[model samples]
Target chain A: MRKFTILAGLLLAVSLAQAQEYAPPKGDAHNGAALFQKFGCYSCHGSWGQGTGRDGPRLNPPPAFPVVLQQLRTPRREMPPYVASIIPDQGVADIYAYLSSLPKAPDPKSIKELQ
Target chain B: MSKRIKRRQFLAGVAAAGPAISLISTTGTAAAQTAPASSIPPVPNDERSLNDMPPQTQGKSGSDFMIDVIKTLDIDYCASLPGSTFRGLQESMINYGGNRKPEFITTLHEDSAAAMCHGYAKVAHKPMACMVHGTVGLQHASMAIYNAFADRVPMIVLTGNIGNSVTRQMNVEWNHSAQDQAITVRDFTKWDDQPQSLQAFADSMVRAYDLATTVPMAPVLITADGDLQEDTIPPGMEKKLYIPKLKMRGHPTGDPALVQDAAKMLVAAENPVIYVNRYARTDNGPALLVELAELLQAPVVDSHGRMNIANRHPLNHSPRREPTFANADVILALEPVDIWGLTNYVADLIGRPDLPPRRNPNLKIIHIGSEMLLTKSNFQDSQRYAQVDLSIAGDAESTMPSLIEAVKSQITAAHKSRFAARGQKLHEMSAKFLDAARQDVAYQWEARPISTGRMVMELWDQIRNEDWMMPTESQFISDWPFRLWDMNKPWHTMGGSGAQGIGYNTPAALGAALANKQHGRVTVAMVGDGDFNMAPGVLWTATHHQIPILYLVHNNRAYHQEVMMIVRMADRRMRSNSPNLYVGTKIEGPNIDYAKIAQGYGMYAEGPISDPKDLAAAIRRGVERVKRGEPALIDIVSEGR
Candidate 1:
């Protein structure tokens, strides 16, 4: 969900980055959803809060609201650049809310899940 | 009368009775969920609905449903060495992606995985995705990616990352990922992304594909985090995901003012020389470049990999960088890779095309390309190389056509050389070289083990006339058959020696062909079989796509170049006999049955062709299968035995 949010963020980046100050869309996941598809984000990222662990960055793993948003608003190199309206502030807030609703971080025992 | 017999045979075949198309495996995953709690594999009887995947509401995170998308995109298989970075996602890819879904091509070396992806892509036309193990995996695959990038192949890489240790608490997240991983491939990639959210992950997929497949195509990579790849989204988001239609930025044209100025300089020069690289990589680059040469009766050097113009054109000269410099009064470097090398050589010879490629006190040099000009000086203390006189870095493809129009507007048609004399000179010179080369023992450029020459000749004898997606190992092709194979059209053949990476033949070539298959051509890769075995897994990708291509395995049992080097070193060191000499470099014992391996992957296969006499016929047979719309392999076994 968060990966989709970031990807959706790229297609609409010009608008999202420029409209950082705009009002939130009514009842939208705002930051609860992060457009993940636009960046080829989830191709490597996980379907849920978990990142695929190689190329995809960690989405808000839990306490999801705004966590994924926080990471996207700031990123490392070689990312096709993104900003707020390209992803909207309200959309970010809604997606953040949506993500916060997902499962919490995996327990340390998750690696045990691999074998 | 024969028709009646054939019909009877056909009827008999039909009466033999075949089963209905069946699901290959309906429950690699679901059997664990439903199926009455049994260990048995799910039967094809149910005919699983791909639409039924992602059972819950897959609202924003489209990850769970991407398997269907991969199917829609026609990705038959992916050749990747598995890693924990993509563990969860890989689970979904296998368990859920379905029968025709891109299957995981297990591999040993990460580079082989990438190269396999490269090979598959050339023919698959769509990206046959390669997955890497975080930073280390990326680093290993970098060479193959570079080759894919340089060759302009469309590849999409899915890298599983363990997000920064401090950033996420996901289990084992610290063991993977590079801080700024995509930076490693920046020089050649079209686009890259590392989404921090599920929704964005899915959306960028469309964007990455669009960019990778755009004109002037190249691979694009996206880093997905292990944490992000498995996250579940809200309900039904799979249906909501949309791949945005992308509009490519077209090639830019020069201002009439700029074109006129450049053209004036070109026509007026006494000893003008043209330098071309990637332009010749494009179908138009060669034509436009040749037109300019014909108009000026000037010499052209092939920094451009393939010989666009006749090499023996009185104006056509060797592209070895130095002499190309001495003879030119004006220089135009089109799509140059080493701008520094070109400029330093032509500093006093040529000037700008958009501006001029020449440097120094006299010659005018123009640098025209879609990307910006980077002189070697960019690396060395930031000093501009003799500095380009005129530089236009947008759409050389379009710019040249217009310049042609402008030059035509001014220069008399009679000014164009009939080029008859020059053509003869080239033919004569080429024959002379081939004659001398056949005898030359210095470097043994003609030594056996499928002398790059023999390989090309065999390839030409086989597939020159049929439409082919030619993904050549950069060096081998340029040395020979470059004169031998005539590529007069865009996408006629795709190759990138620019980066000089091996293992690319398998994946990138296949990927590009996959993208262009509807364009209708047998995608052919003339690669050393050693390289073939390097990423043999890609064959499955090709098989799955049914992309017709002939993979000619130049099976020289040894890495011939290494043996040559070892011999050189031994002779130099005068170590009369080193048992270790050329020991590890060979693939001996019983030579590999590459034909069997190819057949195992579902392809028509032939060879271990030791005799050169068998080369043509075997090649013909292989070419026939490719024409029939199936991948085929010819293991042209050659070595100095």
Candidate 2:
């Protein structure tokens, strides 16, 4: 029983480690715009980080830069991973900064079509 | 001396020289040896030529008689783009046939003709005729034919072929003639035949129709010979022509013992899931499926190949397919295209597929469908083979009643109480998903470059009250309606383009609209821009026929799916700066004016509307225009999906 308890504790520790959050480095918005276009992130997320339905999710009001970096490292769904070897850590950071700095989409209610 | 040689002199010279002299001659010998002393070839007398011709009467043309047989089949329309090979039949259809029962509906392209027939068959639940111009036309129509075949929809394709080489005219006729035109599409169609004579044509036509309409149905081809269609009936030969009666074979039902066995399994299992695709043929199908599911209190996962069940049903588990399947001890698949894919979890990641996840190892799978009834050796649309405990080769809809009865018989009072409790739990889960979907729409509801979720909600608000039919599945706004809209009615959804061809949406929607027009159902479609560009001329046909469809262009300004794929490829190679990827994929820079094109086709047009707020108003106006029995189009500048 004591051994089983220790094993359970170890298992809990492994899961906690896996769930730990990533820390992102400081990035430049201007550099991020160039990286976003250069890395073809704009192809799916759109030129303005407004996601297309068939391609990717929206990122204008960017998620935590760390999460973005993690997504690029180990992607979900159909998105391909961009490892650090392929796209340097700085490139991903720059993309996140650009997305974070991008102008927010205007209210759909303000648009003549949405009402 | 006379320029024309006398027939008597020429004949005398030929007789004296013998036929060998003319045959042995190379250049001038044939003509010179056959010529008289005047140095001119003899012309045959009109009376002599008349004697050589077959004895004939002014009886009806063979094409007219062919139309008579087509009429007996109760075909409503014969869509075609005119070709010379079928000129005789076309003339007969318009004139002698009086064009009433099977009216000749002129389509702009052969693909449009086939696609129109496909959509019509889906709504009407009956196959219609499509005529094409010999080999060239059949080639054009092949893609749509494959689409119909994949979807299990019936269509009878009639293409003109010149069977006799001797009878064919020079140049154009030679180009049009084929030993067998149906060969191009035979692998895709249920059956194909090239009839040699008028009697054969009638028999083949009827047989093709019967084969196409049967369960596990697909498009069938009958290449009508130009000779058979154009030739005048010889004296007394008209009386000999016989038209055979068409026979529609019954749909196969599962063996009673097997159905009972399946029922027992379902009854014994702790959790059972039902998956459906291409299962609903008409309103009765969905009703029967609903009844069966409610009886068993099963969770239904609709693939939306057709509207197999109401999306808003309390037991719908479409959004939770993976979880529901994972939990299921017994899974019953109804006409699913890829049972193997459904049972296995495949990661899209590079090497992650090495260790694919599967459902419970001991899970029992019972597959009921007519997928085994008819199959082609090629095209691979049959999908991968799946291991099943029991496979029933029968039509899902036809087998549902027996299965329902069997399940009902096995249920006890205690079992009923248990099932009711289980059903109540499932109902709550379904409500939760629906609420979640509604909330998801509110996300970015007011974002510019409008969100697909928001777009769908706005459109739904306008058309929810009307009897609306959307006969398309747009990639730009996929599954929005399935999650948010009420689709209980038979004509509410008409499924996707089967072959995944680009040009199917615009014409197919028009075709469904044409069918709905007679029934007074308001037909609408959200078509992708890339698909619309493939055959925008279909708009002309809609205007000309006055097909009152409200067409909305989800113009993302690119072949966005291809762009995504290209980007993924680029990312894998670590080469992000590629102009070629964008060069072919992007449809922007000078954005296509779809509304203007619609206006050119004489349709009520609006937009390139990027603003989200204007969507509802534009859709409302378009719906109003549709209500007034006029075709309309609105172009929405949408973001890529």
Candidate 3:
């Protein structure tokens, strides 16, 4: 799922307007995967990054690394803000790499349940 | 008598008396020191009385008379878990009362029993009685009682306790008995009584039903003593027992002067809105509210406490609550539980429970409900105070007739034209929201790991045509059904758990299904996996009673809501390396097989169906089974949120 996912299209239109001018630094996917669970990002976003429709949007095929970093640094809505002192720049880059590396949601038409 | 002169005879007599006195003192000390004030056993006047003729047993048990009183109240069902304290009454209900009017429903847990009553009341519009084992049962049932109280649903809670210490068994009975069992639910119950005699039980039972069903309805407790239940009616005492005339008082009306004033304000306002929660008590509730809203052409925002109005109605503004409140000049709040929340901007951020008023500076708020008529100092379910320009202390449904008339009288030819113009704009806004919602579902129209929206829409496709009632928690299903489905009936969606308890959805939904069974309404419930695990046994009761329902499990496989909160905490703490958040929160290591669990409870079951394509068929089969008058379940694995 992308930034223009289903529920986010409905609920978080306001939060999606954050500027994404700055790009994040490159980081390792393995460390990112480990940090994703470590930081408890899986709580609102699924363990595999399928965002809770009402709570958080799907992060798979995450937004530009800069947008992800920006959202963490300064959340627009109910999401708690994460400052650099907390989730340092390195941590944010790794988490973004992990999210970006995840597989896209399978096509519903191809899956038996969605048919 | 002359043998007392001998030393041997004197010694024998002294030895026997010594132990007897010692035994008496030991019993006295234990009773005085350890027993509760009411449970203290009286010291024996003479040991000979213990061996005397068995105490005269009553020819007619007092429980028989108690059953007669219960019969008078016309309760249709009585849910209970077995306990020895109420054994006599339980027996009388079966053998004497024939258990037909208020049939005994054996439940596994007291909470489930209470929840069932809660759900049953929402649909039946009358309370179903429930009996639980004394103090422990009430403790188990406290959460459900709180939920019922918060929802303002009427329920009659009959608890059993040993009234006579002399009749109590040594250990278990002592543990089970309370001097005043009503204290257990004193904070939440509208009223309660520990009836000492059959007559008192009769009077209290009638009073409890009256109070529970009155405006600002709530659960009421009546603790029946074991001795009173077991003891035979004192000879001719049956003639003395009087069954009080069970009368449910007409709902009180709003004051005429205040009604006129509120009507005038509403009529004059440029932009007015009606916010309602728990406004409906019967089939009449939604219609009455709609009539008033239509007359004024005002937007009505249902909080989904009860189905106050059809969501698809042009006047319904639920989807646009924030904007509606923002623009309102006059806001009429009816029976809303969270008046403060409706009127203010309460943020979800840390330590800020309240923010500045959400409405306009000069917004005129007129609140009407029996909220002011019933309240308790303990257990603050009532939200923070919200200032109101006018407050009417009466039942919203009852007061609506008079208020509607007043509004009708105030509307002139000029006002009629204004109302039409306003209605058209509101209708357009509603249409826009509906269109947006329709498009929103199309985004993941066929997404794998079925979207909650897709899943609910799929279920809706099957049941939309049936006379359906969905008794579910709002959070579990999200906003999909409300946004998409035609909730045109009062029972279309019976609303959320009153106290926001987790275990409520499964059992309460089942209870609603039981009520729907008689009416031939197809019942469906969307329950969370975490909630189902709380009281899976409800499925057994459904199966045993042949109460058909299609139970759909939103198997996110976690306490997803809590999971969200925990993650936020981890982010704030900068514990970027903490993997233990999942340890306590997620239900993953050995993911539960919900389908198998439902089968174990003897319901037709299928699932752990992850593929969205599989949902429609599974749901169809489940619906078929329910239509065949059997319970069924479908577990659909999906996104965590």
Candidate 4:
């Protein structure tokens, strides 16, 4: 089942890459951080897009820009549809850049509390 | 001996000693008259002289008899704040009766008093009394009373009333008095009464205890009228006032034929799954369930209304309920709080259209519980109805033994081998689920503004060896304890607040700790910031009463659940400029200092600690305080679930 999920995800990523006709504008990570909190995206996704599993999925190492935009416009599950009116194209690109900018979580072995 | 005979003997003894008491009094009077003028101290002008002394009434008041009734019922605690209407009863309990058996536990609010009873009963397995102050107090306690009623917990509520307007002293008494005080809570209570005489009060109290403790248990109220409580008992009425003997009723069991049929269904099925909620009433309850599951080699999904199964048990498939139900040939639910929500898949869509069953289309479902035995129309706690192949009306724990015996009679050698193979597969599945949960927690393990997962794991690591009781729910902490902790003891967890009330966690945890104090177990609870704010004064009550508990505030600085809902609402409306969504939902602007709040209440406390590195040491200090018989609190600035 894990293998099947990985294969399906790769195929979707390839299809989204082929379908995109234009590149998104470069985004500012600092401005994206402010926009993330302003939009209340941190409520479901954490303050850094680290999902709680109870409400939303993790977004660190975010998917391709087109896929994120598509999901926001028309959510497939319980997530509310975030149309362009609620979040413009620039806002989505900035949110993606902020998610990408987050540092990788430290190893559990390195944290004495976790051990 | 009858109380009447004892009263008569006491009166006769007083009559026999009357001459001796008169002679001593007359001698003292003569001696006072002959005393020297210089030896007697002169009275101050401000104080009244001895000649100005007035007469005072002296004898047992009606409240003395009420205290006797309470003592007869063997109630250990009475949780209440002082009120005027029951002031007579309170005085009698302390001075006349010595207040040993039913010690008064002072509380800051009536809701906390009632919720204390709610939490205490789950661990003590017996009802504790809470005194409500007439109409206003009853209204204050109504929510906690409703929570206990919905949870099917037993408790006694004694409300004071001044039924006679003539005897009311002042404006406050008039305001507090009421004609039908118990009526406010009658819909939710199992039984209520306003007893007019001491004999009547004795009989009614025994009846209330019986009704409250029976299966499908709930809170019961008996109004103690102010006038009745203060007025002296008539000279010879003591003979007629006899305490009634309490007789406990046996729990109902499933019918023999129905039990046989249910057992047959389980034995014949290729894949059977057991679902349980609020099923374990005693330690023996979990043992019976374990026996039945082993007999059938079935996977048991504990819905956690109580600690129904060991978390590390091989047959416990709580984390894999969806897949287990999908493949199940036979499903048996024991005392399920919501059968429909468990079986169906309802999405939170725009319309929330009727969803089909998530289980196999041809699956046979059986339900056994006493929930249908007692219900009311005014409250809608009875969840949505779900159609089932078999419905047996009985207490699930009481019926489990009979069902297990029937299953044992039918098992053959061929069935044994098949069951063994199924058990092996389930054991492997349980191990994999635990490993996956461990892997999931490793994410964001060292993040600042500490992850709830890391906080919970740190606390678990400290207290896992100590005999500990967690009286609060785990939903706000992302249910990390359920996934990681090995909760084999019955008191390891006492499910959620039955009515989903906000203020239940703090007082209820303290109440459970009060019960755990005698058993020498460490009590720990993780309360949400929203829940803690509802009754922060409960911390003072815990400190005053010396009820030891380790309270961790999962301080997300927001009513985070509502934040998600508001976000959903905004996106659904396609609203632009949704930045101010946290107006009503967020608890920020000035984050509450829970550590100072706990300190002000005379409890040892630490933090607003956002660093995961500091959590372990702070939690250790709190645990050490609790171990030494003191209350403690730790505030962890954490992620929203």
Top of the candidates by lDDT: 4
* Positional deviation of residue A98's Cα in model 4 after best superposition, in angstroms: 2.7
Candidate 4, CAPRI quality class derived from DockQ: acceptable
Q: Write the per-residue lDDT of candidate 1 for residues B527-618, one digit (tens) a residue.
A: 76556766787677678668777888777676645554454344334441345655766778878988888888888899777665567788
Q: Give the CAPRI class of candidate 2.
A: acceptable
Please provide TM-scores, in order, for all candidate models, with all chains considered together.
Answer: 0.61, 0.87, 0.86, 0.90
lDDT of 2 by residue, B1-641 (tens): 35333334433443364343223222222332243455666666764666676644334567876776786687888888899888888877776666655778888899999999999899988988899999899999999999999888999898888778998998999998898798899889999998778778877888888889988889999887898887776647656666665555678889989999999999877788999988898779889988888887989998888878988999888988777888888999999877887766566556657334446767899999998788899887887788899898899899999999999999999888888888998998998776656554554566556666767777888888898998998445747788778888878987887778888888888888988999878898888899999778888888888889999888878787787777777777766555565778889889899999999988999998999878888989999999988899999887564
Across B1-641, the per-residue lDDT of candidate 3 in tens digits comes to 24112323322432364554334324433442353445666656675556566744335577866876786677989988788878988987766665666799878889999999999999888899888998898899988889899888899998889978888899999999988888888999899888778878877898889988888799999988998998767666655556666656798778989999999999999999999988887899999999999999999988888888998899999888888999999989998877777766666777866665456778888999888788889888877777889999898888899999999998999999999999999998888776666654555555556777778878987887788898897665557778878889888878778888879998899889878988888899999889988888888888888889999998887887777677677667766445476667778879898899989888899989988778888999999999999999998887654
User: What TM-score between 0 and 1 does chain B of candidate 2 receive?
Assistant: 0.90
lDDT of 3 at B250: 95
Q: Give me the TM-scores for chain A across all models, comma-separated.
A: 0.47, 0.74, 0.76, 0.78
Q: Which 10 successive residues of model 3 chain B have the least lDDT summed?
A: B2-11
lDDT sort, best first: 4, 3, 2, 1
For candidate 2, give the DockQ.
Answer: 0.27
lDDT of 3 at B79: 87
Against the hidden true structure, what lDDT does model 3 obtain? 0.80
lDDT (tens digit, per residue) of candidate 4 on B278-377: 8988778888999999989999998788888888889999888788988998989999978887667677778986665456778999999989988998
Question: What is the number of backbone collisions in each predicted candidate, taken in the order shown?
Answer: 202, 19, 10, 1
lDDT: worst 10-residue window of model 2 chain B? B24-33
Give the top-scoring candidate (DockQ). Answer: 4
